[model samples]
Target: MTTHSLIVTGLAAGYGDSDILHDLDLTVPAGKITAIVGANACGKSTLLRAMSRLLKPRAGQVLLDGKSVHKTSPKELARTLGLLPQSPIAPEGITVADLVSRGRHPHQGLFGRWTREDDEAVRAALDVTKTGDIAERNVDELSGGQRQRVWIAMALAQETEVLLLDEPTTFLDINHQIEVLDLMTDLNQTRGTTIAMVLHDLNLAARYADYLIAMTAGRVHVSGSPETVLTEDNVRQVFGLESRVIADPTSGRPIMLPLGRHHVTQA
Candidate 1:
């Protein structure tokens, strides 16, 4: 069984007067992929933000390694936890290798020394993301898929134990989505990285996540394995849609078949 790497208790936060997350409690299992899924306004991004220390919780606490995130220094916290937002701006003239190497900034001193260890991490990240060939290419010149991989490689180079990614596959084609997800799975398996991602693609989330969290009205509706959470009832309640849940041919995990307006059959 995977140990708990991070824990949140009674977490609540929102924009101004509106409360989006209500006493949300969760545990991220060490070295496992935990995917959070819900409709818009369900506090998916808010939760991820709180976990990454980007947003301060209004009510409860987010604990990293049994210590409150509010107490940890930013640089110290970043050395243990990394966050990848849905969309990130890259420096206009930055090369792919340079962009990935920037991830080692946390390990650098005030003078920003470029150590041999930093170079090794950058190389390893490029190797993992398969972006070594484009190492010297300007990041802006790459396709959307290639750019996403570079961003992921940058996160890989951070060498943090926990990585929280928000919509990691937004601009990629289906194939690239699989490639990135597979890479994340490999990282979890080999390096014991605790990954939590907010994914809109239900089928892909089902295929990749070791644990699934369904949120409704700013609270955890239910959570468990793919087969357990992606049920017809849970789908209808959380997403306001009906769907057939079937086994994934490749992974044997539950795959949701959304029965939206376009997918509904005329009676």
Candidate 2:
């Protein structure tokens, strides 16, 4: 498996006339699971978009293995980096098999016919995601959890060295969320794929991520191991909430316990 270094240098990007991400700098460690967590409107998704080349950077550059992503050929870049957007549009009536096959696009050359390698990749992806049973089913007909896994299967079929996911667990139940995160871990360990994702659940992120990046107001507030990045003071500063950070007895990761108005009585 090939590992690619992803870095952002002074990145600034957003919608027209407004920048959601400030002069941000980050380096996603090669072959590790890095989770970006933050409050709403903190630019976590914007940073992922910039890294995936979905959104053009206004001021700086995203580098993949020391090469500018903006300047790379789209097909070449796609072959090396796979991105599962927050809300990817599945073509109406497309089947799971067909959607997964589309991931082979970058690997196919001009006038190239679909080969056994493509079939194998697609098959492996579906099997790993446990979507093989629904391969022929319409993607639109699947439940939210199933649909998300199908999208992830498509990304897996891409066979890229770097995988970027924007809220991959969105709309998933607790079990499904754990399943997806576990699948990501399996992929990283087995294939050495670099995984970077934006997650809303701080506890889950801290538990699953080897490295954690916490953002606030368009900049990275803090980033490190879960123990160092997730602390009482950091939580209060970044989330504007009082909370107790406890060690998970099972995994030894930090678990946040948010205290609200009603949770805190006069002491």
Candidate 3:
């Protein structure tokens, strides 16, 4: 359980001619769960992409343990930093076992043969994700929840110290969403893996994340513990909506209740 630091400095990145992330600076706390929340197209995913080296930074750097990610070799970087994008596409007709095995690619050489360690890693990942039962099933045939678990299993099999997830809970039902977030917490608790993820559900993020980051217009508007970051003023400024922040009885974290036009109480 080696701890690794992931830091972003003056990161400016985007697609085509538009920069989605503007001079963004962030430090992912080592061995902690960090959730990045923001409105649509607020550069949460773009920041993640830059950190994982999927998108090249226009200006600035993403560093893993003080080393530049852009300069690191692909295999070397993948071995230390795993990324699970919002929509991961599997090869047509690939079986669950085969797909999970792909996570071992970074550890294998060009002519390397599968070893017992690879088998054990894949087995452990599948077991933890509860996907072992469907190991031989076709990936495309599984339900959305099952498919998402399999994708997570692949990331787990990679065994990276630092993981970046872009909307990992997308398309999941409430139960499945809780299950996935709980699983991530388990990983952090057991393996001390550093995780940074983009989440849309503010309450869920507050409940599960040790740290919360709220972004607006390609910059981090506010970030800290849930109590510090999920205040009424921050929510109003970040989401452009009136909301009340209350302590969640279950988790004791702040949960936001949006106040729309219809829900009004006379002063």
Candidate 4:
């Protein structure tokens, strides 16, 4: 149950010539779930990519336990950090078992010998994600929800202490979104895995995240507990939307209720 620290210092990353993330400083609390939320193109995903070393930072560095993540060896980093991208591709005709087993690659040596531990890891991941029933099924053939869960299983099988996900709830229905988020919470609780994800749904982000980061124009507007960060003014300024923040009766978490022209009652 050792949780490692992740820090970003003066990080600037983007596509080619354009910088999507400015000089940003962030510290991910160990063993907690942190969600990054903002309007589209606000650099939520870009920040995530930089943190995971998928995108190179132009100005600064991402530090995992005080060491530069980009300078770490690929297999060593993979063993310590797992990333689920916004869109993950499974090779055509690959079975769920095979794809999940691929997560054990980091643990394997140059000889690539598969061990009983590998089998157990894949099985545990599948069972936890409720994808064991489809273990033999082709990943491409499953429904969107099932596919997403299976992909999560693969990440889980990696057995990393830190996990990063980019919009893990993308294309999911409300129920499936909750399912995946709840699963993430379970991972945080049971395994003490440090989880950081980019989420578009403000309400869901507030509900599930222990810490919420609100980004605006490639910079972090504010970050703290959901109740503190989801204030009306911050929401409006970051999202450019008029909204009311309410306490979710179930979890007592902050929930954003957008105010539209038609939804407002004239006094």
Q: Give residue 80's error in model 2 in angstroms.
A: 0.8
Model 3 local distance difference test score: 0.93
- TM-score per candidate, in order? 0.95, 0.97, 0.98, 0.98
lDDT of 3 by residue, 1-267 (tens): 689988889999999999999999888899999999999999998999899989999999999999999999989999999999989899999999999999999999898699999999999999989999999999989988899999999999999988889999999999999999999999899889999999999999999999999999999898899999999999989999889889999979999998888856841
Per-model root-mean-square deviation over C-alphas: 1.9, 1.4, 1.1, 1.1
Per-residue lDDT of model 1, residues 21-116, tens digit only: 999998887789999999988999999989988888899999998999878998998889999987889999999999999999899999998999
Writing each residue's lDDT as its tens digit, candidate 4 over 1-267 gives: 787999999999999799999999999999999999999999988898889888889999999999999999889999999999999889999999999999999999999899999999998899889999899999989999999999999999999999999999999999999999999999999999999999989999999999999999999999999999999999889988888888999989988888878857731
Q: Weakest 10 consecutive residues, lDDT, candidate 3?
A: 258-267
Q: How does residue 219 of candidate 2 score in lDDT? A: 91
Candidate 2 local Cα displacement, residue 210, angstroms: 0.3
CA error at residue 180 for candidate 3, angstroms: 0.4
Candidate 1 TM-score over all chains jointly: 0.95
CA deviation > 4 Å runs, candidate 4: none
lDDT of each: 0.90, 0.94, 0.93, 0.93
Better of 1 and 4 by TM-score: 4
By lDDT, the candidates rank as 2, 3, 4, 1
